[model samples]
Target: MGDKANCNCHTGNAVYGLGLIGAAIYFISQATSFIMGVLGFVKALFWPAFLVYEAFSYFAV
Candidate 1:
């Protein structure tokens, strides 16, 4: 029973991460590549940069 909860936590985290990536790709598509979907998806592979920027910007203030 305890193990099941732990497993679900990890699974949920993985799903959340994937969802963020998908969202980033969608936003990029809307901004730059609505015509060529793959370009935005390729760009979204660097989603970590946005996350890092947000973290630094938040703390810098």
Candidate 2:
């Protein structure tokens, strides 16, 4: 009953955790240099923000 209310919180965390891992793998794989790999790791941490920004730019005039 009351416990079910907290389930949604965990679900969001799981989704974000998975997304972060996937993004890290993708960005790091594409990186050719060690510095680029480090940059990719940082970029992976903010992938969602970059996504939203691109989405807004694409949809905006």
Candidate 3:
């Protein structure tokens, strides 16, 4: 099985890790920009929502 078939576990982990990295990048970008006024406001309003999303993604995987 190791030699003949490709394992999907590693790929899934890599994708989940990449998703977290991308989320961090997006959050940082949103935080650093002053022009994204509405987005910033919305983010502030839903910070807990983001946290919940992250928690579920991390734990439910």
lDDT leader: 2
User: How do the predictions measure up, each by TM-score?
Assistant: 0.42, 0.82, 0.41
The C-alpha local distance difference test score for the whole of candidate 1 amounts to 0.70
lDDT, residue 33, model 1: 42
Worst-scoring 10-residue span by lDDT in model 2: 5-14
Per-residue lDDT tens digits for candidate 2, residues 8-43, read 557777888899999999999999999999999999
Candidate 3 global lDDT: 0.65
lDDT, residue 60, model 3 = 98
State in Å the error of residue 22, model 2. Answer: 0.4
User: What's the C-alpha lDDT at position 22 in model 3?
Assistant: 64
Better structure of 1 and 3 per lDDT: 1
Return the clash pairs for model 1, or none: none
Arrange candidates by TM-score, highest first: which order?
Answer: 2, 1, 3
Give the true-structure RMSD of model 2: 2.1
